[model samples]
Every structure is written in C-alpha cells, then in structure tokens.
Target chain A: MKKVLSGNEAFARAAYEAGVGVVSSYPGTPSTEITEHVSEYTEIYTEWATNEKVATEVAIGASLGGKRSMTCMKHVGLNVASDPIMTLSYTGVNAGMVVIVADDPNMYSSQNEQDSRHYARFGKIPMFEPCDSSEAKQFTKDAFALSEEFCTPFYIRSCTRVSHTQTVVDLVDRVEGPAFAPENNIPKWVMIPVNARRRHKLVEHRTELLTELAEGDKYNKVTMRDKSVGVVCAGVAYNYVREVNPEASTLKLDMVWPLPIEKIRKFSESVDKLYVIEELDPFFETEIKAAGIKVEKLERSLCGELSVDAVRALFNGEEYEVESDNSLPFRPPNMCPGCSHRGMFYAINRLKLFVTGDIGCYTLGLLPPLQAINTTVCMGASIGMGHGLDKAAEGMSEKAVAVIGDSTFLHTGINSLINTVYNKGNSTVIILDNGITGMTGHQPNAGTGCDIHGGNTPKIDYVNLIKSIGVKPDNIRVVDPFDVTACMETLKEETAKKEPSVIITNKPCIFADRTVIDAPYFIKEDKCSGCKICTRLGCPAILWDGEKRVAFIDETLCTGCHLCIKVCKFGAIEQRSK
Target chain B: MKLDILMVGVGGQGTVLSSNIVCDVALANGFDVKKSEIHGMAQRGGSVVTHIRVDEEVFSPTIPAKSADIVVSFERMEFLRYADYYGDNTTLILNTQVIAPPSVGDGSAEYTDDKVEEVKKQFSKVYATDAISKAIELGNPKIAGMIILGILAKAVHFKKEAWEQAIKDRVPPKTIDLNMKAFDLGYNI
Candidate 1:
C-alpha cells in the first residue's frame, strides 16, 4: 500500500516493517516523530529516554541482547549519545542497530547546525542520506540489514527539509530479522583496552568492505544525462539539483559516508565538469578534492537550507534572491498568551538577575521585552554555568541564577545540581515545571508521569530529588509561576541566600492544559493608565494602541490566564464576563 | 503539468492543514504530490509557509522562486511578505485579516493599510476577501483557512467532488458539515 509520510514517519514505518524489537529516543524537532510513530506498533517496545545518551544506551543494550534496535534524535542529541556511539563502533553489535540522527542544516529548532555525516565519519560508521520520504523508508530498511551484515551500528542522517517534508511511500509487510542466540564473547563485547585494540582492527576491516559495497550501484547511483555538467549531491540537495538541472549528469550518493572514492572519480571523469552540491558543510566536496579529483568549487553561502532556486542560481552564476519584504514587521516566535514561564521571567527581569538559561520553550525569554535569560548554551548547562559564574565573579552570587525546564532539569540539570552541591556552590536554580516537555511538541519525560505510549508512570518529585542531593529542605521552595507577586518574592528570597537554593515554578503549559485558561481579559478605557506596565510582559495577546495611548487585549489570541490583569496596577484590565 | 501552491500565514492560522487538504485533493485527482513545511519554533506565532507541488511527477517539495502558480495567504501582511515568490502569471488568493506582530504592538514596526494596496497593485489576478469574518459568520473563526482553500479550489482545475472528499477525509467527522459549509461559502465568493 502507498501512503503519504514524512521522512520521520517513514523511518518509523520502515523500522516496524523491518521488525525492530526495540526503539528509544528523546524528543527533538524533525526526529521526535520517528519514535512517537514507532510507539503505535504494539510489537515494538518503545520509550522516551531522559536524554539522548540514555536513549542510545537503551538501544545499545537491546542490540546486545540479540534484537534489532533503533534510536532516533536530532543532530545535537547525537553529541550526547556520541560517547557510546564512538565506542560502540569498536565493539560491534550483536544484532542490527541503526542510529537515526536528523540534522538541522538551517538550525531550525537546533542550537547548532553541525552535520551528522561528520559523526558517521568520526565514529567510523557507515551513513545513509535519503532525498525524500520514499528513499527514507528504503534506506532505513537497507541500513538495518547492512548493520547486521557488517556487525556494526549504522547512521541514517536526515535534515529538516527531508524529515519534515511529506511524500508518497510504499509500505510492506513485516520481515522479521534473523534472530541471534546470546553469546558471551568477552573480547568481542567488552571494550577494555586490550579487547578494544583487537576490536579496532575489525572496525577498519569493516570500513574497507563497506567502501567496496558503497562503490557498487546499490548505494550510489550515476545518472548519465548531458555530460557537459555533473552534480555530486546527497540527501535533500539531490532533489533540488534534480528539480533545476535534471538534464545534467548526476551522481546521487544514498550512502554518504564510506563514499565510493573510485566511483566518484569515475563519475567526475565521465562528465565535462563536476560540481559538488550539498547543504551546510562541503563534506563531499572537501573529500573529493582530497582524493585528488578536480571539481568546480562554487561559491555558495554555507548558511541556511539549499532550495531549488539556490541550485538554479548557482548554475546561472547569479544569487538566489530570497522573496522577502524588509518593510514587513519581524514576527519572531514568542511565548504563548498564557505561557506559564511569562510571570516567572517577568519577575526575573524585574530582579535584574543574570540568568543562565537552558534549552526548552523558556529560551524565548532571551528575546525582546522580558529579556530575563543571559546565557543558553545547551541542555542542562544553566545550572553548571550559573554555578561557575557565581564562583568566578565575587559579587555575582546574589545576582546569578539558573533557569531550566522540568523536563530538561531531569535530563541533565540534576547532574549539574549534584556537582553544585558537592562543590559548595551558592547559585540558585529555578526549575520551570510546566508538567511536559513544552519545546518539542510536549513529549512526556521522566518527570511528566507518563510514558511514550500515554501510559501512567511514577512522576519524579523535584523537591525530594534536590534534598537527597544535599540541598536543605528549607532551601527548596515551590511557587506558582502564574502568580507574579509570589514568584517575584520567592526569587528575591532565594537569590539572597548564601546556600544553594532550588525554586520550582509549578504550572502546566497552557497548550498542555487548556483548563487553566478562563475568560478573556479586556481593558476598561475609563480606568486606563497608559503606563505600558502590562506591555512589558510581552504577551502576544496584549497590543498597544499608540493613538489612544492605552493597551487593549486581542480576545481571539488571549488564553485569559489573568496574567496581564495582575501586571496592570490600574483597575483597567478586567476579565470578560463568560 | 505541474502546479505549485505556496501557502503563507501566521503560525496558528491552519496553513499546514489547508496545504494537507490541497495535497489530498491532488492525490484524489490522480496526481503525484509532495509538501514541505518547517515546524517547531515557527509554530509559535511566527511566520509560517508551506510549499506544495502537484504534478504528473514532482521532484522538489519546495517551489522554485517566482514560480508559484498560486499563492494563498491567510493574512494581509503575510501575503506581501513573499513578494519575490510572485510572478506575472501567479494568481493570489488572500484573506483580508491582519494580525499585528509584537514589533507592531511595541510601535517598533508599522503595519499600515498601504500593504493591502501594494498587494492589489502588484498582483494581476488577486482574489481578496474577509474569510475570517465569513468563517466567524459560519460559527467558527478557525475555518477561515478552509474558506481560503475553497477560493484556491476554484483557481485549480480539480472537480468540486474531489475537494469535498478531501475535506471529509482530512477534517474531524463531527465538524465536517461546518467545514463543508465554510468551503462552499468561499467557493461562491
């Protein structure tokens, strides 16, 4: 049967059809849907691990137990899981294992635009890149088989364009992989120094065999069209090339890593001119050049995504003029109308605290109006960075604070908290407990009291977790983030303390819990004072009438959480009658 | 023959769902379809766009610059945002509604009425309507996107039955009637 599917969805369907027994992942954009879809198949045991490292370890454990296993995560998540993947390359898997890493070439929902192909090369594993959803399914199934054949873990690299794009895919029945009996080969499974040294030799041998396999037409294809111009591309870039220059000779690499060196050289020789086209990094171009092959080095921006227009412009020797109007107002992503993080960030901004922010929805706090967050390096870096900032700067103890989301706190902030306590750091850490992973479409985490399958699970108590890690019970305070005054007072009290403090802002994300939204708020024109205090909250629902010099709420956009009402000192803003 | 439809709107204006319906209509009409849109941060009240291609054979999910056969926008400002995507032959179906961004709210930017005039002067074939108000008259403001899709349906050569079937397949069963009414309201406009 043929069905429309995104690249992420295709990967999930392919994994199920390939009879994958175990699937694990942490939610991240462009890749989160893979595991979410995998959970629908009852035959597969799926989970939302606390972080990518844990997810990778779980899949690794399942692979070692003689079952085909898969783990999916975004490009940055691969960094956290890389420790295991780099070593797992040396210690080959017992069963077929595939790591699906979706790269955000344009940094769409990612902190960095690092290419996952580099990871495949760094870990010495074969990587496959699919152009569209159809290829995504076929490559995933082929990747699993190749992994088992080579006795190594394989990488399937997807970008935002491919993963988020939907196209037709052909579905097939479940073809269960060959089952393996558990074996206790210490030298093969264990990665101690002496054993790892021997396993390293096997890794090199596997690479050679994979390179030869890549050289064949199975993984790499050469389209002999007009030999005047040749294009070497992979993943979504191939689609753009095909869209614009279909008449040109093309060398599309389905297997990006372990690139067929001889095949590339032959393709270059076949055409009059060879052009390497790929998004972000010039991995293929650099490698082809290093192989001593002469290819045209086109000057293109290494930033953002490559599009059909970009390819046309490249061949025409002109720039792709992005259709954009500068006069149009910039519409940056903002906090929702009744966002739970609003009041807390409002208080933090009032306090003038130097906040070390972590990844999540709260990262938006760094933008305009309520610029509360000072630094956002990565997941769970807020606590450690805050602690380090306080230790380095003498007078920054009271001014420094760390803000993290509940899901992210559970992911890695807990480790940073333990380090902070052990090192006697005096920084205050605030956990924005919105009950769900608010950023990547609200996936359940360890603290959310739910599993990937929507089954109930024990919720992690932040207070007890913090206390057990040496923080005093009195130092941990739970406050309602929606209540602006209470949030402000609690923050002020915690930052003044010399000891390490943990503040938990308890409120469900408005999108997660619509029950919190009441009647929409409106402003009484008679009682209005045009002080713009409510506007400082930067609520998307609140707009200022410059002519009237008063603020009015857009009832359509308002969630009616009464946050703006609290900020309005004058008796102007009132809840609309239901 | 290839048809490229570019849908632009605010994040929550249902561009994704509308584009999905367009793809479904194309599929029901026996055409190959590919659709592409960015998710995540762009979903939070930011500018969102979807590129959809329907043809005998579709290569790139994204439409080439200035080659969009039809451009449907859910808001006035958003319609003007992608001026580069419009060619002389491009037909524009725009919703006459304005959702001011934070910059406009803060007085850092101006969203003037001149934008609507600019859109009228630039595009040769323009179909502009208050779809939001019409949707609200139909009992729900959210169906404005459906109304825009209805206008889009008239621009294409597909049969009305294909659009109805696509809508029925895409929407919830309970609200199918309301959505169909909204679509018809747009179709007649």
Candidate 2:
C-alpha cells in the first residue's frame, strides 16, 4: 500500500516490518515521533526511557537477549548515549541493533547544531542517510540487515529536512525471523583487558568488511549526466543537488559513514569539476581530500538549513537572498497562557534571584518581562550548575536556585540532587511538575505514570524520590505555583536554608488537561491602574492596553490560570465564568 | 497543474491538522503530494509555518520563496510574516484576526492597523474574512482553521466529496458536523 508518511513515520513503519522486537527512545524534536509511531503497532514493545543513555542501555540489553532492538535520539542526545554506544561498537550485538540519530543541522528546535555523523565514524559504526520518505523506509530495513551481517550497531541519520518532511511511501509486510539465542562467549560479551585487546582487533576487521560492502551498495548511485560537474552529496543535500543542477553528474550516497572510495574516485574521474555540496561541516570533503581527490567545497553559510536556491547559487555563481518580512513583529516561543511556570518566574524575577534553567517550555522564562534565568546549559544541568555557582562564590547560595521540569528532573536532575546533598551544597532546587513532558508535545515521562501507548504504570513519587536523594522531609515542600505570594514565601524560606532544599510546583499543563475551562480574566475598566504588573507573567493572553492604560485579556487565548490575578496588587483582574 | 500551499498561523491554531486534510484530499485526487512542518517549540504559541506541494510529481517538501500559489493564513500578523511565500499570482485567504505577539504588548514592536492592506498590495487576489468570528457564530471557535481550509478548497479544483471525506478522516467524529458547517460557510464566503 502507498501512503503519505513523514520520514520519522516511515522509519517507524520499516522497523515494525523488519520484526524489531524492542524499541526504546528519549523524546527530542525531529526524532520523537519515530518511537511514538512505533508504539501504535502492538507487535513491537516501545518505551520512553528516562534519558537517551538509559534508552540506549535498554536497547543494548534487549539486543543481548536475542531480540532485534532499536534506540533513537537527536544529535545532542547521541552525546549522552555516546559512552554506551562507543563500547557497543566493540561488543557488538547478537541480534540486529539499529540506532537512529536525527541530526538538527539548522538548530530548528535544538540548542546546538552538532553533527551526529562524526559519532558514527568515532564509534566505528556504519551509518546510512535517506533522502526522502521512500528511501527512509527502505534504508531502515537495510540498516537492520547491515547490523546483523557485520555484527555491529548500524546508524540511520535523519536531519530536520528528512525527519519532518512528509512524502509518499510504499509499505511492505513484516519479515519474520527467529530470535537468536544468547551464546556463552565470555571473550566476546565481556570487555576485560585481555578480551578487549582481541575485540579491538575484531572491530577494526569489521570496519574493513563494511567498507567493502559500501562500495557495491546499490543505494549509493552515480547518475552519469552532463559530465561538466560532479556534485557528491548525501541525505537531504542530494535533493538540493539534483534540484539545482539536474543535468550535472552526481554521486548520491545513502551510506555516508564508511565512504566507498573506489566508487567516489570513479565518479570523481568522470566529471571535469568536482564539488562537494553539503550542509554544515565538511565531513565528506575532509575525508575525500585525504584520499587524494581534488574537490571544491561550496561557499555557503555553515549555519541554518540549506535550500534549493542556495545550492543553485553556488553552481551559477549568483547571490541568492531568501525573502523575509522583517517588518512583522518577532513572535518568539513563550510560556502558554495559564502556565504554572509563570507564578514561579514572576516570583523569582521579583526576588532578584540568580536562576539556572534547564530545557523545556520553562526555558522561555529567560525572555523579557520574567527574565529570571541566569543561564540555561542543557537538559538536567541546572541543578549541578547552580550547585557549582553557589559553591564557587561566597554568600551566593542565598541568591541562587535551580529550576527544572518534572521530566528533566527524573532524566538527570536526581543525580545532581544526590551530589548537592552529599557535597553539602546549599542550593535550592525547584521542579516544575506539570504532569507531562510539556515541551515535546506532552509525551509521557517517568513522572506521567503512563507508557508510550498510554498504558498506566507506576508514577515516580517526587516527595519520596527527593527524600531518597537524602533531602530532609522538613526541607521538602510541595506548593501550588498559581499562588504567587505563597510561592514567593516558600522560595525565600528555601533559599535562606543552609542545606539542600526542594520545592515542587505542582500543576498540570493547561493543554495536557482535556477538561480545562476557558474562564478568561478581564480587567475592570473603572478600577484599573496602569501598573502593567500582569504582563510580568509573560502570558500571551494578557495584552497591555497602552491607549486605555489598562490590561486586556484576549478571550480566545486565555485559559484563566489566575497567575496574572495573583500578580496584580490592586485586585483589578478578575476571571469571568463561562 | 501544480499547487503550492503555504499555511501560516500561530501554534494551537490547528495549522497542522488543516494541512493534513489538504494532503489527504490531494492524495485522493491521485496527485503526488508532500508537506513539511517544523514542530516542537512552535507549539507554545509561536509562529508556525507549513509548506505543502501537490503536483503530478513533487520532488521537495518545501516550496521555494515567491513560488507558492496559495497561502492560507490563520491570523493577520501571520499573514504578513509569511508574505515572502507570496508571488504576484498567488491567492491569499487571510483570517481577519490579530493575536498580538509579546513584542507588541511590551511596546518593543508596533502592531500596525494597515497589516492587511499591506498584504493586499503585494498579492493580486486577497480574500480576508473574520474566520474566527465565523467559527464562533457556528458555536465553536476551534473550527476557525476549518473555515480557512474551506476557502482553500474553493480556490483550488479538488473534489468536494474528497474534501468532505478527508475532513471526516482527519477530524474527531463528534466535531465532524460542526467542522463541515464551518467549511461550507468558508466555501460560500
């Protein structure tokens, strides 16, 4: 059957048809849907692990237990799972193990545009890149075969262009196969010094065999057209190459990691001018030049996404400017109307606290009005960084605190809590527990008490979890963040303490709750003072009426969370019942 | 005939859902279709743009600048934001609703009153309507996205039956009748 599917959905369907038994992943943009879609098929066991590292380990354990397993994450996520992935390359998998890493070259929804292709080379694993949804499905199944044939973890790289784009895909039936039984090979599975030395040699030998297979890979094709120029490209860059210079001879590589030098050289010889057209870093050009091939790297910005016109400009030597309307007001992502994070951010901003932020919707609190966060490093780094900042400076503990999401706290913040308690660092930690993972489309986390398929599971109790991390029960407090005065008092009391403290702001995200009411708040035109205090919450619903010197809430946008009401000192804002 | 559509709106406006219906209708009509959307952070009341192309054979999921044939904007401010996608021959159907950005309320940027007029000057054909108001008149403001989809259905030559079927296939069963009514209002308007 033919259907329209995004690259992520296509890969998920392929994994299901390839008889993949276990699928584990941590939800990150451009890669979250792969596991979410896979969970729809009852035949496969899919899960949302705590972190990418844990997800990779779970997949590795499943692979060792004789099942075809897969783990996926975004490019930055590869960094977290790299420790296990690098070693998995040496130990290898008993059954096929495919690792899907979606690279965000444009930093679309990512913090950094770090390339994952380097990880494939660094870990000595074979990586494949698919251009569109059709190839995404085909290459996914091929990735499994390559993993089993070479007895190594295979990589399937999908960028934002490929992962989020939707196109036509042809479906296939599941390829049923028996699960491989675990073998009692201590030298292969265990990595002691003597066994590691032997495995290192085996890993090197496996790379050589994979390179030989890549040479004859049918997916890596060279279309001999007008031989004036040869553009070597892979993944979505291939589409740009073809769109720009359709008649020019091109080398489209589906297998990017272990380059088929023999084929590249042959294609390089056919055309007069050799150009490596790619986005971001020159991973291909660096190796191609080292192999003694003459190629010209295209002149383009190394930042953001590549376009069809951008590629054409490089060939035609013409300047291409992407037309944009700069007159429109910049609408950056903000905390949703009625968000629980607002009350805390408003309190922190008022108290003038140095806050270390983590990833999620609350990261938007760094923007103006409630510009409270001092630094936002990455996922689960707020606690540790805040601890270090407090310990490094004298009297800093009284003014510094770490703010993290419920999902992120479970992901890696617990370790930071342990470090804070054990090291005796006097830093306050705030967990914004909004029930679900609020940032990435409300996916279930360990705190959500549900699996990927919406099945109920044991929810992680935050109070006990904090206590288990050695935080005293007296120092642990759960408060409703919508109450701004109470939250401010709690923040002040916790930050003044000479020991580690945890305050969990408990509220469900408005969007996550289906039964949420739309009791929009309106300002009393008569009792209105032009303080602009309500805008400090940074809620999109509140609009400052500069002409009338009053605040007006857009009824369509407001959910009546009442955070703005709490911030208003004059009692001017009131929510009207629907 | 090739039809390149650009959907510009704020998040939570059901832009993705509308584009999905368009793609399904195009597929039902037996034309090759492709659509692309950047999600994740955009869901938090940020600017969201979706590119959709339908042709005998579509190669790329993205539409080049100044190449789109039709643009369906869910809000007035979003209409100006995606003006780059408009060509001289492009047909623009804009919802006459303004959801102020943070910069506007904070006094960093001005929300001009002539926003729709500016868009009208660029594109040859502009159809501006109070889509949200029309959806509200029908007792559900959530169907504002469907109202704009109805305008797009009239602008293009797709099977009405296919569109209705696509809506049924895409929207929730309970909201199907109301959405269909919203679509009819948009189709006639």
Candidate 3:
C-alpha cells in the first residue's frame, strides 16, 4: 500500500515492517515522531529514555540480547549517545542495530546544526542519507539488514527537511529475521583494552568491506543527463539540486560515509565539471577533493538550510536574497497564553536573578519581556553552570539560580544537583516540573507517570529525589508556578538562602491536558491603569493598545489562568462570567 | 503539470491541517504530493509556513522561490512574511485577520496597515476575505482554515468532490459536517 508519511513516520513504519523488536529514544525536534510512531505497533517494545545516552544503551542492550533494535534522536542528542556509539562500533552487535539521528540545519528548534554524518565517520560506522520519505523507509530497512550483515551498528542521518516533510511511501509486510539466541562471547561483546585492540582491527576490516559495498550502485547512483555539469550531493540537498537544475547530471550518494571513492571519481570523470552541493558542512566536498577528484568548490553559506532557490542562485552566480520585509514585526516563539512557566519567569525577572537555564520549553524565558534566564548551554547545563558560577564568583551564590524543566532535570540535572550538595554550594536550583516534556511536543519522561504507550509508570518524586541527593528536606520547596505571588515569595526565600535549595514549580503544561483554560479574561477600561504591568508577562493573549495606553486581553486567545489578574494591581483584568 | 502551493499562517492557525487537506486532495486526484513544514519552536505562536508541491512527479518538498502557483495566507502579515515565495502569476487567497506578535504588544514593534497594502499592490490576483469572522459565524473560529482551503480550491483545478472527500477523510467524524460547511462557505466566496 502507498500512503503519505513524514520521514520520521516512514522510519517507524519501516522498523515495524523490518520486525524491529526494540525502539528507544528521547524526544527531540524532527526526530521525536520516529519513536512516537513506533509505539503504535504493539509488537515493538518502545520507551522514552531519560536521555539519549540511556536510550542508546537500551537499544544496545536489546541488540546484545539478539533482537533488532533502533534508537532515534536529534543531532545534539547524538552527542549524549556518542559515548556508547563510539565504543559500540568496536564491540559489534549481536543483532541488527540502527541509530537514527536527525540533523537540524537551520537550528530549527535546536541549538546547533552539527552534522550527524561526522558522527558516523567518528564512530567508524556506515551511514545512509535519504532524500525523501520514500528513501527514508527504504534506507532504514536496508540499514537494519546491513547492520546484521556487517555485525556493526549503522547510522541513518536525517535532517529537519526530510524528517518533517511528508511524501508518498510504498509500504511492505514484516519480514522477521530468524532470532539468534543471546551469546556469551566476552571478547566480542566486552571492550577491554586487549579485546578492544583486536576489535579495532575488525572495525577497520569492516570499513574496507563497507567501502566496497558503497562503491556499487546499490546505495550510490549516477544519473547522466547533460554531461556539462554534475552535482555530488545527498539527503535534502539532492532534492534541491534535482528541483533547480534537473537537466544537470547528478551523483546522488545515498550512503554518505565510507566515501564511495571509486563511484564518486567515476561520476566526476563522466561529467565536464563536477560541483559538490550540501547543506551546513562541506563533508562530501572536502572528501571528494581529498580523493583526487576535480570537483569545483562552490561558495555556499554553511549556516541555515539549503533551499531550491539557493541551488539555482549557486549555479547562476547570483546571491539568493531572502525576500522579507524589514518593516514587518518579528514573531518570535513565545510562552502560551496560560503557560505555567510565565509566573515563574515573571517572578525570576522581578528578582533579577542570574539564571542558568537548561533546554525545553522554559528556554523561551530568555526572550523578553521576562528575560529571566541568563545562560543556556545544553540539556542539564543550568545546574552545573550555576554551581560553577557560584564557586567561581564570590557572593554570586546568593544571586545565582539554576532553572530546569522536570524532564531535563531528570535527564542530567540530578547529577549536577548532587554535585552542588556534595561541594556545599549554595546555588538555587528551580525545577520547572510541568509534568510532561513540554518542548518536544509533550513526550512522557521518567518524572511523568506514563510510559511511551501512555501506560501507567512510576513517577519520580522530585522532592524525595532532591532530599536523597543530600539536600535538606526544608530546603526543598514545591510551589505552583501559576500562582505568581507564591512563586515570587518562594524564589525570594530560596535565592537568599546560604544553603543549596531546590524549588520545584509544580504545574502541568497547559497543552498537556488543557486544564488551564477557564472563562476568558477581559480588562475593565474604567479601572485600568495604563502602566502595562500585565504586558510585562509577555503572554500572547495580552495586547497593548498604544493609543488608548491600556492593556486588554484577546478573548479569543486567552486561557484565563488568572495570571494577568494577579499582575494587575488595579484589578482591571477579570475573567468573564461563564 | 506541477503545482506549488505555499500556505503561510500563525503557528496555531491550522496551516498544517489545511496544507494536509490540500495534499490529500491532490493525491485523491492521482497526483504525487510532497509537503514540508518546520515544527517545534515554530509552533509556539510564531510565523509558520508549509510548502506543498503536487505534480506527476515531485522532486523537492520545498517550492522554488518566485514559483508558487498559489499562496494561501491564513493571516495578513504572514502573507507578507513569505513574500519571496510568490510572483506576479501567483494567485493569493488571503485571510484578512491580524495577529499581533509580542513585539507589537510590548510596543517594541509597530503592526501597521502598510504591510497589507504592500501585499495588495504586489499581487493582482489576490482574493482577500475575513475567513476568521466567517468561521466564527459558522460557529467555531478554528474552522477558519477550512474556509481558506475552500478559497484555495477555487484557485486550483481539483474537483470539488476530491476536496470534500479529503476533508472527510482527515477531520474528526463528529466535526466533518461543520468542516464541510466551512469549506463550502469558502468555495462560495
């Protein structure tokens, strides 16, 4: 059957058809849907791991137990999983294992556009890049088979364009491979110095064999049209090239790693002039050049995504101007109308505390008019960075606060908080427990009392977790983030403390259950002061009428969490009568 | 025989759903369709866009610059936001609703009529309407996108039955009648 499927969805369908027994992942943009889709197939055991590292190890464990396993995460999540991936490459898998890493070229919902192809090369694993959803399914299924054949883990690199785009995919039936019993080969499974040294040579031999396989027409292909100009590209870039310059001969490399040196050299020789086209990094370009191929080096911006227009402009020797009106107001992503984080951010903004923020929806607090967060490095960097700031700068402990979400705090912030208590640091750590993973479309985490399948799971209690980590019971305070008054008072008391404090902002994301929605709020024009104090909350529902110099709520957009009512000292904002 | 449709709207304005309906309609008519949109942060009240191409064979999921056959704007400013994607031959189906961004609300930026005026002057085949008001009149403001898709259907060559079937296939069974009514309201407009 043929169906419309996004790349991530296709990957899941392919895994199902490939009879994948285990699927594990931590939700991240462009890649979260893969595991989410995988969960629909009851035959597969799916999980939302604490972080990418844990997810990768889970898949690794499943593979060692003689089952085809897969783990999917965004490019940055691969950084956390890289530790296991690098070593797993040495200690080959018992069953087929595939790691799907989706790269965000334009940093769309991501911190950096770090290419995942490098990880495939860094980990000495074969990698495949699919251009569209159809290819995504085919390549993913092929990846599993190739993994088992080579006795190594394989990488399937997807970008935002491919993963998020929906295209027609032809489906197939499940072809379950014969299950192998769990083996007890210590030298093959374990990675000690002696075993690893022997495994290293096997890894090299596998690479050579993979390179030979990549040279064939199976993964890499050459299309000869007008031989005047040819482009060597892969993934989404190949689609742009095909769209803009269809007449040009093309060398589309489905397998990005292992070089495909002979195929690339032959393709280059076939065309009059060959040019390398790719987004972000020039991995293919640099490698093609180093292989003694006479490919032209085109100047392309290493930032952002490559578009069809960009390819046309590159060939025409013209700059692709982004057609945008500067006069138009910018619409940056903001907190929702009744976001639970707003009250906490409003209080933090009022306190003017130096906040070390972590990843998730709370990162939006860095935007005005709240601008509460000061530093955001990675997943759980806030706690560690805040503690480091306190230790390095005198008197900073009293002013520094680390803000993290419940999902992220469980991911890596738990260890950082333990470090704070162990080192006797007085850094204030505020855990924004929104009950669900808010950023990546509300995937359930360890703190959430649900599994990937929405089945009942033991929820991790933050209060007990913090106390067990050496924080005093009195120092751990849980407050409702929607209550601005309580949030402010708690933050004031917590930030001023000379001991390590853990503040848990207990509120479910408004989107999680839509519980924040109530009667719409409105402003009484007569009682309103034009002070714009409610506007400082930066809620999308609140609008500032410059002419009237008064603030009013957009009833259509308002969720009536009564946050603005508390912010309004004049009692101008009131909920409508239901 | 390739048609490139660009749908632009605010994050929660149902642009993704409308584009999916367009894809379904195209597919029902035996055409290959590829649709692309960025999710995540862009979904949080930010300007969102979806590029959809329907043809016998679609290569890139994204429409090339200046080649969008039809531009569906769910909000006025968003039409101007993606001005680079359309040209003189493009037919624009615009929803005359203004959503103020945070910058506009905080008085850091001005939301002016000049942007809408610029869009009107640039495109000769512009079909502007208050779809949001029409949707509200139809009993739910959220069905505004179906109205815009109805206008979009007039610009494209798909059969009316194809659109109706596509809508029925995609929407919830209980709200299918309401959505179909909204689509007809747009088609009549």
Candidate order, DockQ descending:
3, 1, 2
Residues A1-578, candidate 2: write the lDDT tens digits.
88889999999998988999999999999899999899998899999999999999999998888889999898888988999999899998888999999998767788999878899889899999998999999998988877888899999999988889999888889985457986567888898889888999999999998888888857688889999888899988887787667788989888998999888899999899999987888889989999999997556667777777778787877776667777778888888888878898888998999999998999989998899888887889999998998889988989988999999998888898899999998999999999888888899888888888888899989999889889999999999989988889999999999999999988888866756656788988777787877776788988877788778888777887877777788888887967
Can you rank all candidates by TM-score, best first? 3, 1, 2
C-alpha RMSD of each candidate structure in angstroms: 1.4, 1.7, 1.3
Question: For residues B135-175, what per-residue lDDT tens digits would candidate 1 score against the true structure?
Answer: 88999999998888889998899999999998998899999
Clashes of each: 0, 0, 0
lDDT of 1 by residue, A367-478 (tens): 8899998898989999999999988998787987899999899888899999999999999999999999988888888888889877999999988989999999999999
DockQ of each: 0.75, 0.66, 0.81
Supply candidate 3's per-residue lDDT for A277: 92
Model 3 over residues A1-578: C-alpha lDDT tens digits?
A: 87888999999998999999999999999899999999999889999999999999999999988899999999999999999999999998888999999999889899888988888888899999999999999999999989999999999999999999999988989888559788689999888999999999999999999999998867788889999998899999998898888899998899998889888888888899999999988898888888888978566888888888888888887887666677778898888888889999999899888899999888999999999988888999999999999989998978879999999988888889999999999999999888899888988888889898778999998888888899989889999887888988988888788899999987788877675679999999989889989999999999988888888889989987888888889988888998
Question: How high is the CA lDDT of each candidate model?
Answer: 0.89, 0.87, 0.89
In model 3, which residue pairs have backbone atoms overlapping below 3 Å? none
Candidate 2: stretches off by over 4 Å: A318-323, A515-518, B106-108
The CA-based lDDT of model 2 is what?
A: 0.87
